[model samples]
Target: MPDWNRRSVLATGAALSTTGILAAVGSTVAEEDASTEGVATGDPPGWSSVHGNAANSRYLPLDDGFPEPNTIAWRSDTLYGVSNDGDIAVVDGRIYIVGEFESTDYEQTELRVASTDDGTLEWKTEVTGRQRPTVADGTVYVSGVDRVTAFDTEDGSLQWVREFDSEQWISNATAADGEIYVVTGGTRFNADATLYALDGEDGSIQWKRKQVEARQENRETADPAPVGFKSAPVAVANGSVYAITGGGEFKGSGSKPGLQWNGGVTALDAKTGEKQWGVVLEDGAFIKIIATDAFVCVQNMPDGLEETVLDSETGETVLTSNSTRAATADVRVTHDTFRPSSGPITVSTYGTDDSWTASDIYYFPPLIAGDTLIATRTSESSIVGFDLESGTEKWNWEFDGTPHALAGVDENTLYFKLYKADRPTELIALRASDDRGEGREGDDRDETEPDDDTEDGSDESDSDC
Candidate 1:
């Protein structure tokens, strides 16, 4: 298993200059009827946020089936100087992007919006630091090194800006209901971690919760010890904020070893900054959290990956699996390799225990679209989709350049980008096929399918890459 670090896990995508493109393309903002306070505007019927929606399920329910091979609908013109890590956020017809653009004289980060039909540059705003943009209620929210700003979705005008007093780094904003939730932490070692809830309309601070505190008992001899939020971003569901907080001391000349780290999930009321329940994950670091209708799945890395599913109402453990990283209501992706360069990736169904029925080897995380599990081949510019139930290869597609990120997917299209260091980034949109064939039957399969095979054991299969 490869060791995962904070930087690699939260690394964002980059963008290129639209200096001339913005001038050539002309657009008008669509006027939407105003809704009551605390009510968020609806995202278009597709993949809106990075995690699909506010619950961070990363599951897209498309009735029109998944994308098939060799179904290219259109490809946007290459955008030069865009980083390989930059991502796109789609709302209605608007596509929001954040990335660093480099020119001969200088380099700067930018927030841009483009049209979904033609990928035309609508507007661009210069920003500091790079973080993925979040859109809701006709507004775009962006976070920087020490502040969070909101811009009008229509005109690219600054609506509100909220700054922090201390040197703090803010994570991506999760907007839901009528509030925006963000996790923040101190820049210095052992600094405190905080979660802030701001108004969606005016950016006013409604409530703030301190999750962890900084501590330095032996400042002179021991390394600075800090504790704070360690997860990538916070997940909100059932009127609650789901996040993790933990910290450990760096091993120094005189610091006490093995006594510095602990973490767990802490649930708080979304309306007020009050604690509901907390579970301590002793000797484990909380890596990710995904909230769904049935459970709140948490990824804890003590040695390898350990996924725990807890009841949404009561934080009780309902199911547990080893090496499981991604999950939907029916299927899970698990493997022993931490940074798998070329190894088996298990596709399993779980009820109380996991049943590894299918396998593949991929460098990036697999995405579940409807009943199919899609993944990119390890060290190759190809992607394959597999049926979750029958373990059959449904479709495969090869790209001209190395695929960088799976931007998103909607009912009729799958969006992704290709990378070539000397060339501009190529954004491609593929038409999703409506013919699901036999795989559509797996969607209604029982959660507790037969597990006659060995429990928690993976099937050895040859790589088809």
Candidate 2:
């Protein structure tokens, strides 16, 4: 196995999810009952943003949906992939996606709104963005190369555009509690990075935090390697902001050129930008992290490494392991679900010392929704759900189109990108059951079709959907 790092992961356009290390082998496909229970009807849960929420935990706290969906809800017509920045954002009864359609020249960028109740196109707006769109407080925020643009949910109209100068590059923008937290930095080594909190109503910086650490080195021995937050993504939850801070380049025996080392997770006060606590790695750097209100999970190095779970409030090791290896974090939350190539799904949680390893071909991101673990495999076009604790196979829903990425989950529906070879991709929704009888009563919203306005939300691109 190769030593994995951030640069290698980014180059592949995929992430080796932080779940436990594994070797997949035997394959099983069974039609199991995906019965769902306990739905709060007045309002169904929505994926709303990346990794389920601002915390980026990937853990959607919904009791109504079955993680192992056994039926298809609806599928969108062939949709082309544009310069995608993030996954689909589910809000209210509508889903917002960034893509292109019927564009042979690839110049126009479109943001389409559709009903999750059934895949109905509600409205389309010309928008500029790359990462996953974030819907918050009636607005959809999209971050691109030069600026961060906002669009209204009601009619997909232009809300605002926050542009930056040439020296500073916008990394990512996450919204929470009426404020959008953004990170901007220079790509060069040892460059300064800044985090800005912006107002949700308009593109205005509320507060900015710039924390820079100088390179520390021995004049006669090692090179100066500056380390800080750089351009890493953050998790915001419960009045706290968490980021994996590291920097520069290392020349260890088999070290890669563009990868950073000596990095770990750091927690800061969300409201004040004050540093709270941090756990820096001394041996190997962190691969990924997931932050929840209860715990923060970190996935570290060496290809076959396990998981590490830490208490969110304190920078303390709370994981109890019976194995010879240390614990891991972040695997339980949302991840860029990837195929492990070969490995049995080895899963363990922090709550109990007992663990289980289930035989499966590929283990994508371990998204724990209620009691079901929503997993995907690359062997065949299939989505499988496993019993979160017992590792029991729930259901394997296969499709002819290739499944790209797991966007988000809402109520009983799982939204993802599916593409056919040489043809444009499609937006697919999978459900736990075939009948709407499992859905909460009144889960459907009052339908309204707004006159979509192209070029309405675009800043530097042509509007065509």
Report the C-alpha lDDT of model 1 over 93-144, residue by residue, as the tens digit. 7777766644232224666676555455666666554567788888888777
Q: What is candidate 2's lDDT per residue for 262-318, written digit by digit as tens? A: 555566655545555555443223434566655766654433233345577664555
- Highest lDDT, which number? 1
lDDT of 2 at 105: 38
RMSD of each: 15.1, 13.8
Give me candidate 2's TM-score against the actual structure.
Answer: 0.70
> Deviation in angstroms for 327 in model 2?
14
Superposing every Cα of model 1 onto the true structure, what RMSD results?
A: 15.1
295 in model 2: Cα distance from truth in Å? 3.1
lDDT agreement of model 1 with the native: 0.56
- State the TM-score for model 1: 0.70
Q: What is the lDDT of residue 108 in candidate 1?
A: 42
Residue 151 CA displacement from its true place in model 1, Å: 1.6
